[model samples]
Target: MTWSIVARDPETGAIGIAVASRFFAVGARVPFIAPGTGAVATQALINPLYGPRGLALLRGGAGAAEVVHALVADDSGRDHRQVQVMDARGRFAAHTGTDCVDWCGAIADDLCGLAGNMLAGPQVLEETARAFRENAALPFPRRLLVAMAAGEAAGGDKRGKQSAGLVIHGTEDWPDLDIRVDDHPEPIAELARLERVSRERWVHFKRYLATGADPVGITDRARIDSEIAAAVAAAQAQDAGEPAAGKAPAA
Candidate 1:
Protein backbone atom coordinates (compact mmCIF):
# COMPACT_ATOMS: atom_id res chain seq x y z
CA MET A 1 0.00 0.00 0.00
CA THR A 2 2.75 2.47 -0.82
CA TRP A 3 4.20 4.53 -3.66
CA SER A 4 7.61 6.15 -3.80
CA ILE A 5 10.17 7.96 -5.95
CA VAL A 6 13.93 7.72 -5.72
CA ALA A 7 15.99 10.23 -7.69
CA ARG A 8 19.43 11.79 -8.07
CA ASP A 9 20.01 15.40 -8.96
CA PRO A 10 22.83 15.32 -11.55
CA GLU A 11 23.73 18.98 -11.25
CA THR A 12 23.98 19.02 -7.43
CA GLY A 13 24.80 15.39 -6.84
CA ALA A 14 22.00 15.34 -4.30
CA ILE A 15 19.98 12.20 -3.83
CA GLY A 16 16.51 11.85 -2.29
CA ILE A 17 13.33 9.82 -1.87
CA ALA A 18 9.70 10.79 -1.37
CA VAL A 19 7.08 8.28 -0.26
CA ALA A 20 3.49 7.98 0.94
CA SER A 21 1.50 5.03 2.13
CA ARG A 22 -1.65 3.87 3.80
CA PHE A 23 0.62 2.14 6.27
CA PHE A 24 1.81 3.97 9.37
CA ALA A 25 5.38 5.30 9.70
CA VAL A 26 6.33 4.44 6.13
CA GLY A 27 9.15 6.95 6.49
CA ALA A 28 10.89 4.82 9.09
CA ARG A 29 11.12 1.88 6.71
CA VAL A 30 10.64 2.70 3.03
CA PRO A 31 13.20 5.29 1.88
CA PHE A 32 16.92 5.13 2.54
CA ILE A 33 19.62 7.41 1.12
CA ALA A 34 23.32 7.97 1.66
CA PRO A 35 24.98 11.18 0.62
CA GLY A 36 27.14 10.81 -2.47
CA THR A 37 26.17 7.18 -2.69
CA GLY A 38 22.60 6.36 -3.73
CA ALA A 39 18.95 6.02 -2.70
CA VAL A 40 16.52 3.13 -2.25
CA ALA A 41 12.80 2.72 -1.66
CA THR A 42 11.52 -0.70 -0.62
CA GLN A 43 7.83 -1.41 -0.26
CA ALA A 44 5.09 -3.99 -1.07
CA LEU A 45 5.75 -6.81 1.37
CA ILE A 46 8.61 -4.49 2.41
CA ASN A 47 11.98 -6.13 2.77
CA PRO A 48 13.84 -3.64 4.92
CA LEU A 49 17.24 -5.10 4.01
CA TYR A 50 17.07 -3.62 0.51
CA GLY A 51 17.67 -0.11 1.87
CA PRO A 52 21.07 -0.52 3.59
CA ARG A 53 22.25 -3.44 1.50
CA GLY A 54 21.52 -1.54 -1.70
CA LEU A 55 23.44 1.48 -0.45
CA ALA A 56 26.42 -0.71 0.52
CA LEU A 57 26.44 -2.22 -2.93
CA LEU A 58 26.28 1.20 -4.58
CA ARG A 59 29.13 2.33 -2.35
CA GLY A 60 31.06 -0.68 -3.56
CA GLY A 61 30.71 0.67 -7.11
CA ALA A 62 27.76 -1.47 -8.13
CA GLY A 63 25.43 -0.01 -10.77
CA ALA A 64 21.77 0.48 -9.99
CA ALA A 65 20.72 -2.50 -12.07
CA GLU A 66 23.45 -4.67 -10.55
CA VAL A 67 22.39 -3.81 -7.05
CA VAL A 68 18.78 -4.70 -7.77
CA HIS A 69 19.81 -7.97 -9.33
CA ALA A 70 22.02 -8.92 -6.40
CA LEU A 71 19.34 -8.07 -3.89
CA VAL A 72 16.62 -10.14 -5.54
CA ALA A 73 18.97 -12.99 -6.34
CA ASP A 74 19.75 -13.65 -2.69
CA ASP A 75 16.29 -13.13 -1.27
CA SER A 76 13.96 -16.08 -1.02
CA GLY A 77 11.02 -13.69 -0.67
CA ARG A 78 11.78 -11.56 -3.73
CA ASP A 79 8.42 -12.30 -5.29
CA HIS A 80 6.63 -10.43 -2.53
CA ARG A 81 8.76 -7.29 -2.51
CA GLN A 82 8.99 -4.05 -4.46
CA VAL A 83 12.26 -2.12 -4.53
CA GLN A 84 13.94 0.66 -6.46
CA VAL A 85 17.52 1.90 -6.53
CA MET A 86 19.19 5.00 -7.94
CA ASP A 87 22.96 4.85 -8.02
CA ALA A 88 25.55 7.63 -7.87
CA ARG A 89 25.82 7.66 -11.65
CA GLY A 90 22.20 8.79 -11.98
CA ARG A 91 21.17 5.37 -13.24
CA PHE A 92 17.94 3.83 -11.93
CA ALA A 93 16.58 0.30 -11.63
CA ALA A 94 13.45 -1.12 -10.05
CA HIS A 95 11.70 -4.42 -9.37
CA THR A 96 8.12 -5.27 -8.54
CA GLY A 97 7.54 -8.84 -7.58
CA THR A 98 4.99 -10.88 -9.50
CA ASP A 99 3.13 -11.66 -6.30
CA CYS A 100 2.84 -8.08 -5.16
CA VAL A 101 -0.68 -6.69 -4.93
CA ASP A 102 -2.50 -5.56 -8.03
CA TRP A 103 -1.72 -2.10 -9.40
CA CYS A 104 1.91 -2.66 -8.41
CA GLY A 105 4.77 -1.98 -10.81
CA ALA A 106 7.60 0.46 -11.56
CA ILE A 107 9.04 2.91 -14.08
CA ALA A 108 12.59 4.16 -14.44
CA ASP A 109 14.47 6.87 -16.31
CA ASP A 110 18.05 8.09 -16.26
CA LEU A 111 17.73 9.93 -12.95
CA CYS A 112 14.74 8.42 -11.19
CA GLY A 113 12.91 5.25 -10.21
CA LEU A 114 9.17 5.28 -9.56
CA ALA A 115 7.35 2.40 -7.93
CA GLY A 116 4.09 1.64 -6.17
CA ASN A 117 1.90 -1.22 -4.90
CA MET A 118 -1.86 -1.16 -4.40
CA LEU A 119 -1.95 2.22 -6.09
CA ALA A 120 -4.92 3.93 -7.71
CA GLY A 121 -3.49 2.92 -11.09
CA PRO A 122 -0.44 3.23 -13.36
CA GLN A 123 -1.21 6.92 -13.72
CA VAL A 124 0.08 7.47 -10.21
CA LEU A 125 3.61 6.44 -11.07
CA GLU A 126 3.39 8.04 -14.51
CA GLU A 127 2.35 11.42 -13.12
CA THR A 128 5.04 11.24 -10.45
CA ALA A 129 7.86 10.78 -12.95
CA ARG A 130 6.38 13.39 -15.25
CA ALA A 131 6.19 15.99 -12.49
CA PHE A 132 9.72 15.35 -11.34
CA ARG A 133 10.98 15.69 -14.89
CA GLU A 134 8.89 18.79 -15.57
CA ASN A 135 10.05 20.54 -12.38
CA ALA A 136 13.76 20.26 -13.02
CA ALA A 137 14.44 23.84 -12.04
CA LEU A 138 13.01 23.44 -8.52
CA PRO A 139 15.25 22.92 -5.53
CA PHE A 140 15.87 19.23 -4.90
CA PRO A 141 13.57 18.87 -1.88
CA ARG A 142 10.79 20.93 -3.44
CA ARG A 143 11.04 18.91 -6.62
CA LEU A 144 10.51 15.75 -4.63
CA LEU A 145 7.53 17.20 -2.79
CA VAL A 146 5.88 18.41 -5.99
CA ALA A 147 6.41 15.07 -7.67
CA MET A 148 4.81 13.21 -4.78
CA ALA A 149 1.99 15.74 -4.74
CA ALA A 150 1.25 15.02 -8.37
CA GLY A 151 1.08 11.31 -7.63
CA GLU A 152 -1.23 11.94 -4.72
CA ALA A 153 -3.40 14.05 -6.97
CA ALA A 154 -3.58 11.29 -9.54
CA GLY A 155 -4.89 8.96 -6.79
CA GLY A 156 -2.46 7.90 -4.11
CA ASP A 157 -2.39 4.65 -2.15
CA LYS A 158 -5.51 2.78 -3.25
CA ARG A 159 -6.17 1.87 0.37
CA GLY A 160 -5.91 5.61 1.35
CA LYS A 161 -3.16 7.76 2.90
CA GLN A 162 -1.84 7.67 6.43
CA SER A 163 1.79 8.79 6.35
CA ALA A 164 4.33 10.44 4.07
CA GLY A 165 8.03 11.29 4.09
CA LEU A 166 10.73 13.26 2.28
CA VAL A 167 14.46 12.69 2.63
CA ILE A 168 17.41 14.33 0.85
CA HIS A 169 21.14 13.96 1.19
CA GLY A 170 23.62 16.58 0.05
CA THR A 171 27.43 16.70 0.43
CA GLU A 172 27.27 15.97 4.15
CA ASP A 173 26.89 12.44 5.48
CA TRP A 174 23.74 13.56 7.27
CA PRO A 175 20.51 14.25 5.46
CA ASP A 176 19.98 17.79 4.17
CA LEU A 177 16.25 17.47 4.83
CA ASP A 178 14.30 14.66 6.53
CA ILE A 179 10.66 15.24 7.28
CA ARG A 180 7.82 12.86 7.98
CA VAL A 181 4.13 12.94 8.75
CA ASP A 182 3.26 9.73 10.46
CA ASP A 183 -0.38 8.66 10.90
CA HIS A 184 -1.93 11.87 9.68
CA PRO A 185 -5.34 12.04 8.05
CA GLU A 186 -3.73 14.25 5.42
CA PRO A 187 -0.16 13.08 5.64
CA ILE A 188 1.19 14.62 2.44
CA ALA A 189 -0.13 18.06 3.33
CA GLU A 190 1.36 17.76 6.78
CA LEU A 191 4.66 16.72 5.30
CA ALA A 192 4.59 19.77 3.04
CA ARG A 193 3.96 22.03 6.03
CA LEU A 194 6.91 20.51 7.83
CA GLU A 195 9.06 21.13 4.77
CA ARG A 196 8.15 24.81 4.78
CA VAL A 197 8.90 25.06 8.51
CA SER A 198 12.25 23.34 8.01
CA ARG A 199 13.24 25.87 5.35
CA GLU A 200 12.51 28.78 7.69
CA ARG A 201 15.21 27.75 10.17
CA TRP A 202 16.54 24.20 10.11
CA VAL A 203 17.84 24.34 6.56
CA HIS A 204 19.78 27.56 7.20
CA PHE A 205 21.01 26.32 10.57
CA LYS A 206 22.38 23.15 9.03
CA ARG A 207 24.82 25.16 6.92
CA TYR A 208 26.69 25.96 10.15
CA LEU A 209 27.22 22.33 11.09
CA ALA A 210 30.73 20.92 10.70
CA THR A 211 31.17 18.84 7.58
CA GLY A 212 33.98 17.18 5.62
CA ALA A 213 35.04 20.49 4.06
CA ASP A 214 34.79 22.46 7.32
CA PRO A 215 35.68 20.82 10.59
CA VAL A 216 35.13 23.86 12.80
CA GLY A 217 31.95 25.33 11.44
CA ILE A 218 30.97 28.82 12.60
CA THR A 219 31.43 28.56 16.38
CA ASP A 220 30.30 32.10 17.01
CA ARG A 221 26.70 31.77 18.14
CA ALA A 222 25.90 35.43 17.44
CA ARG A 223 27.12 35.25 13.88
CA ILE A 224 25.18 32.08 13.20
CA ASP A 225 21.96 33.57 14.55
CA SER A 226 22.51 36.77 12.55
CA GLU A 227 23.04 34.84 9.38
CA ILE A 228 19.89 32.77 9.96
CA ALA A 229 17.87 35.91 10.59
CA ALA A 230 19.19 37.50 7.44
CA ALA A 231 18.36 34.41 5.42
CA VAL A 232 14.79 34.36 6.73
CA ALA A 233 14.32 38.07 6.00
CA ALA A 234 15.68 37.70 2.51
CA ALA A 235 13.40 34.73 1.85
CA GLN A 236 10.39 36.62 3.11
CA ALA A 237 11.29 39.59 0.91
CA GLN A 238 11.72 37.38 -2.10
CA ASP A 239 8.38 35.69 -1.45
CA ALA A 240 6.74 39.11 -1.40
CA GLY A 241 8.59 40.17 -4.54
CA GLU A 242 10.29 42.98 -2.67
CA PRO A 243 13.97 43.87 -2.54
CA ALA A 244 15.94 42.51 0.39
CA ALA A 245 17.13 45.04 2.94
CA GLY A 246 20.21 47.05 1.92
CA LYS A 247 19.50 46.19 -1.73
CA ALA A 248 17.98 48.69 -4.17
CA PRO A 249 14.99 47.67 -6.26
CA ALA A 250 15.53 47.36 -9.98
CA ALA A 251 14.25 50.39 -11.92
Candidate 2:
Protein backbone atom coordinates (compact mmCIF):
# COMPACT_ATOMS: atom_id res chain seq x y z
CA MET A 1 0.00 0.00 0.00
CA THR A 2 3.02 2.22 0.20
CA TRP A 3 6.44 2.97 -1.24
CA SER A 4 9.21 5.26 -0.06
CA ILE A 5 12.70 6.55 -0.69
CA VAL A 6 15.13 7.46 2.13
CA ALA A 7 18.40 9.12 1.27
CA ARG A 8 21.32 11.39 2.17
CA ASP A 9 22.48 14.16 -0.12
CA PRO A 10 26.16 13.61 -0.70
CA GLU A 11 26.86 17.26 -1.38
CA THR A 12 25.06 18.86 1.58
CA GLY A 13 24.74 15.97 4.02
CA ALA A 14 21.01 16.56 4.30
CA ILE A 15 18.70 13.57 4.79
CA GLY A 16 15.23 13.18 3.27
CA ILE A 17 12.32 10.95 2.32
CA ALA A 18 9.72 10.95 -0.48
CA VAL A 19 6.78 8.60 -0.23
CA ALA A 20 3.34 7.93 -1.77
CA SER A 21 0.60 5.42 -1.23
CA ARG A 22 -3.04 4.48 -1.77
CA PHE A 23 -3.80 5.47 1.77
CA PHE A 24 -4.83 8.57 3.69
CA ALA A 25 -2.18 10.83 5.18
CA VAL A 26 0.65 8.46 4.55
CA GLY A 27 2.83 11.31 5.74
CA ALA A 28 1.78 10.99 9.35
CA ARG A 29 2.98 7.44 9.75
CA VAL A 30 5.81 6.66 7.37
CA PRO A 31 8.65 9.15 7.49
CA PHE A 32 10.95 10.20 10.35
CA ILE A 33 14.26 12.01 10.71
CA ALA A 34 16.78 12.82 13.46
CA PRO A 35 18.52 15.60 11.58
CA GLY A 36 22.26 15.04 11.89
CA THR A 37 21.60 11.45 12.91
CA GLY A 38 19.65 9.75 10.09
CA ALA A 39 16.26 9.11 8.41
CA VAL A 40 13.74 6.26 8.66
CA ALA A 41 10.56 5.11 6.94
CA THR A 42 8.18 2.45 8.22
CA GLN A 43 5.34 1.13 6.08
CA ALA A 44 3.32 -1.93 5.05
CA LEU A 45 1.57 -2.56 8.34
CA ILE A 46 3.67 0.22 9.72
CA ASN A 47 5.09 0.04 13.19
CA PRO A 48 4.94 3.73 14.05
CA LEU A 49 7.37 3.04 16.85
CA TYR A 50 9.99 2.38 14.18
CA GLY A 51 10.14 6.05 13.34
CA PRO A 52 11.09 7.35 16.78
CA ARG A 53 12.83 4.28 18.09
CA GLY A 54 14.89 3.85 14.95
CA LEU A 55 16.13 7.42 15.09
CA ALA A 56 16.94 7.10 18.76
CA LEU A 57 19.13 4.14 17.96
CA LEU A 58 20.80 6.01 15.11
CA ARG A 59 21.33 8.99 17.38
CA GLY A 60 22.92 6.56 19.78
CA GLY A 61 25.43 5.74 17.04
CA ALA A 62 24.00 2.52 15.69
CA GLY A 63 24.75 1.77 12.05
CA ALA A 64 21.90 1.70 9.55
CA ALA A 65 21.84 -2.09 9.43
CA GLU A 66 21.90 -2.39 13.21
CA VAL A 67 19.03 0.05 13.55
CA VAL A 68 16.92 -1.93 11.12
CA HIS A 69 17.75 -5.15 12.93
CA ALA A 70 16.91 -3.80 16.35
CA LEU A 71 13.62 -2.43 15.04
CA VAL A 72 12.53 -5.68 13.44
CA ALA A 73 14.00 -8.13 15.94
CA ASP A 74 11.95 -6.70 18.78
CA ASP A 75 8.66 -6.44 16.90
CA SER A 76 6.38 -9.46 16.85
CA GLY A 77 4.90 -8.25 13.55
CA ARG A 78 8.22 -8.22 11.81
CA ASP A 79 6.87 -10.58 9.20
CA HIS A 80 4.20 -8.06 8.24
CA ARG A 81 6.03 -4.76 8.20
CA GLN A 82 8.48 -2.88 5.98
CA VAL A 83 11.18 -0.42 6.99
CA GLN A 84 14.15 1.50 5.58
CA VAL A 85 17.04 3.35 7.21
CA MET A 86 19.78 5.70 6.07
CA ASP A 87 22.53 6.79 8.43
CA ALA A 88 24.57 9.99 8.45
CA ARG A 89 27.50 8.20 6.89
CA GLY A 90 25.56 7.29 3.72
CA ARG A 91 24.92 3.69 4.82
CA PHE A 92 21.39 2.45 4.00
CA ALA A 93 19.40 -0.62 5.02
CA ALA A 94 15.92 -2.01 4.39
CA HIS A 95 13.54 -4.84 5.29
CA THR A 96 10.35 -6.26 3.74
CA GLY A 97 8.51 -8.66 6.00
CA THR A 98 7.78 -12.05 4.55
CA ASP A 99 4.07 -11.50 5.09
CA CYS A 100 3.89 -8.22 3.21
CA VAL A 101 1.61 -8.14 0.20
CA ASP A 102 2.73 -9.15 -3.23
CA TRP A 103 5.45 -7.13 -4.98
CA CYS A 104 7.12 -6.19 -1.71
CA GLY A 105 10.86 -5.70 -1.57
CA ALA A 106 13.64 -3.13 -1.17
CA ILE A 107 16.90 -1.73 -2.55
CA ALA A 108 19.67 0.01 -0.67
CA ASP A 109 23.27 1.22 -0.92
CA ASP A 110 25.41 4.16 0.21
CA LEU A 111 23.32 6.59 -1.85
CA CYS A 112 19.73 5.67 -0.98
CA GLY A 113 17.11 3.13 0.03
CA LEU A 114 13.85 2.24 -1.76
CA ALA A 115 11.13 0.03 -0.29
CA GLY A 116 7.54 -0.80 -1.10
CA ASN A 117 4.70 -3.26 -0.70
CA MET A 118 1.42 -3.95 -2.53
CA LEU A 119 3.09 -2.22 -5.49
CA ALA A 120 2.57 -2.63 -9.20
CA GLY A 121 5.85 -4.49 -9.56
CA PRO A 122 9.57 -4.24 -9.01
CA GLN A 123 9.73 -1.58 -11.73
CA VAL A 124 8.16 0.88 -9.32
CA LEU A 125 11.21 0.72 -7.12
CA GLU A 126 13.67 0.37 -9.97
CA GLU A 127 12.45 3.50 -11.79
CA THR A 128 12.28 5.46 -8.52
CA ALA A 129 15.85 4.68 -7.54
CA ARG A 130 16.99 5.26 -11.10
CA ALA A 131 15.51 8.75 -11.16
CA PHE A 132 17.08 9.64 -7.82
CA ARG A 133 20.50 8.49 -8.98
CA GLU A 134 20.21 10.25 -12.33
CA ASN A 135 18.72 13.59 -11.27
CA ALA A 136 21.72 14.73 -9.28
CA ALA A 137 21.53 18.39 -10.31
CA LEU A 138 17.97 19.08 -9.14
CA PRO A 139 17.33 21.01 -5.95
CA PHE A 140 17.24 18.41 -3.14
CA PRO A 141 13.48 18.49 -2.63
CA ARG A 142 12.74 18.51 -6.34
CA ARG A 143 15.07 15.62 -6.90
CA LEU A 144 13.19 13.55 -4.33
CA LEU A 145 9.86 14.51 -5.91
CA VAL A 146 11.08 13.67 -9.42
CA ALA A 147 12.08 10.24 -8.25
CA MET A 148 8.72 9.61 -6.53
CA ALA A 149 6.88 10.94 -9.60
CA ALA A 150 8.78 8.54 -11.78
CA GLY A 151 7.70 5.69 -9.54
CA GLU A 152 4.11 6.82 -9.82
CA ALA A 153 4.37 6.81 -13.59
CA ALA A 154 5.69 3.28 -13.41
CA GLY A 155 2.39 2.16 -11.84
CA GLY A 156 2.86 3.08 -8.20
CA ASP A 157 0.91 1.50 -5.33
CA LYS A 158 -1.05 -1.15 -7.23
CA ARG A 159 -4.15 0.02 -5.40
CA GLY A 160 -3.81 3.70 -6.62
CA LYS A 161 -2.62 6.99 -5.18
CA GLN A 162 -4.28 8.99 -2.43
CA SER A 163 -1.53 10.58 -0.36
CA ALA A 164 2.16 11.49 -0.54
CA GLY A 165 4.82 13.30 1.46
CA LEU A 166 8.29 14.84 1.33
CA VAL A 167 10.42 15.60 4.42
CA ILE A 168 13.97 16.88 4.72
CA HIS A 169 16.44 17.76 7.48
CA GLY A 170 19.31 20.15 6.91
CA THR A 171 21.20 20.40 10.22
CA GLU A 172 18.57 20.55 12.92
CA ASP A 173 16.19 18.22 14.70
CA TRP A 174 13.36 20.02 12.90
CA PRO A 175 12.88 19.71 9.17
CA ASP A 176 14.05 22.28 6.62
CA LEU A 177 11.15 21.40 4.33
CA ASP A 178 8.12 19.23 5.03
CA ILE A 179 5.29 18.88 2.53
CA ARG A 180 2.29 16.58 2.56
CA VAL A 181 -0.58 15.95 0.16
CA ASP A 182 -2.99 14.12 2.35
CA ASP A 183 -6.01 12.52 0.66
CA HIS A 184 -5.41 14.14 -2.73
CA PRO A 185 -6.84 12.47 -5.81
CA GLU A 186 -3.46 13.03 -7.41
CA PRO A 187 -1.10 13.28 -4.48
CA ILE A 188 2.18 13.22 -6.32
CA ALA A 189 1.17 16.02 -8.68
CA GLU A 190 -0.23 17.98 -5.76
CA LEU A 191 3.04 17.51 -3.90
CA ALA A 192 4.88 18.81 -6.96
CA ARG A 193 2.63 21.89 -7.02
CA LEU A 194 3.16 22.49 -3.30
CA GLU A 195 6.90 22.14 -3.69
CA ARG A 196 6.88 24.83 -6.39
CA VAL A 197 4.60 27.07 -4.33
CA SER A 198 6.92 26.82 -1.32
CA ARG A 199 9.65 28.76 -3.10
CA GLU A 200 7.28 31.70 -3.41
CA ARG A 201 7.72 32.65 0.29
CA TRP A 202 7.92 29.74 2.70
CA VAL A 203 11.43 28.80 1.68
CA HIS A 204 12.72 32.33 1.97
CA PHE A 205 10.69 33.07 5.09
CA LYS A 206 12.08 30.04 6.91
CA ARG A 207 15.52 31.54 6.63
CA TYR A 208 14.44 34.10 9.24
CA LEU A 209 13.34 31.49 11.76
CA ALA A 210 15.51 31.04 14.84
CA THR A 211 18.34 28.51 14.54
CA GLY A 212 20.50 26.88 17.18
CA ALA A 213 23.32 29.35 16.70
CA ASP A 214 21.01 32.35 17.07
CA PRO A 215 17.85 31.43 18.96
CA VAL A 216 16.71 35.05 18.75
CA GLY A 217 17.03 35.46 15.00
CA ILE A 218 16.46 38.78 13.19
CA THR A 219 13.45 40.69 14.53
CA ASP A 220 13.72 44.07 12.83
CA ARG A 221 10.77 44.38 10.43
CA ALA A 222 12.72 46.63 8.05
CA ARG A 223 15.67 44.29 7.95
CA ILE A 224 13.51 41.18 7.53
CA ASP A 225 11.54 42.66 4.64
CA SER A 226 14.57 44.03 2.82
CA GLU A 227 16.53 40.83 3.20
CA ILE A 228 13.62 38.64 2.19
CA ALA A 229 12.96 40.83 -0.84
CA ALA A 230 16.57 40.51 -1.89
CA ALA A 231 16.57 36.73 -1.39
CA VAL A 232 13.37 36.37 -3.37
CA ALA A 233 14.74 38.37 -6.28
CA ALA A 234 17.95 36.36 -6.31
CA ALA A 235 16.01 33.10 -6.23
CA GLN A 236 13.68 34.22 -9.00
CA ALA A 237 16.61 35.20 -11.16
CA GLN A 238 18.30 31.89 -10.60
CA ASP A 239 15.06 30.07 -11.43
CA ALA A 240 14.95 32.01 -14.69
CA GLY A 241 18.46 30.77 -15.52
CA GLU A 242 19.87 34.26 -15.16
CA PRO A 243 22.60 35.31 -12.79
CA ALA A 244 21.26 36.84 -9.60
CA ALA A 245 21.29 40.66 -9.52
CA GLY A 246 24.77 41.96 -8.64
CA LYS A 247 26.12 38.42 -8.46
CA ALA A 248 28.18 36.46 -11.02
CA PRO A 249 26.85 33.20 -12.49
CA ALA A 250 28.49 30.01 -11.36
CA ALA A 251 31.74 29.11 -13.03
> For this target, which candidate reaches the highest TM-score against the unseen true structure?
2
Worst 10 residues of 2 by lDDT: 242-251
Q: Estimate candidate 2's RMSD in Å.
A: 5.0
Q: For each candidate, what is the lDDT?
A: 0.86, 0.87
* RMSD for each of the candidates: 5.6, 5.0
TM-scores vs. true structure, each candidate? 0.93, 0.93
Clashing pairs in 2: none
lDDT (Cα, tens digit) per residue for candidate 1, span 52-169:
8998999999998999999999999999999988887888888899999989999987768899999999999988888888777666777778788888888989999899988889
Clashing pairs in 1: none
Best by lDDT: 2
For candidate 1, the TM-score is 0.93
Task: Write down the worst ten-residue block by lDDT for model 1.
Answer: 242-251
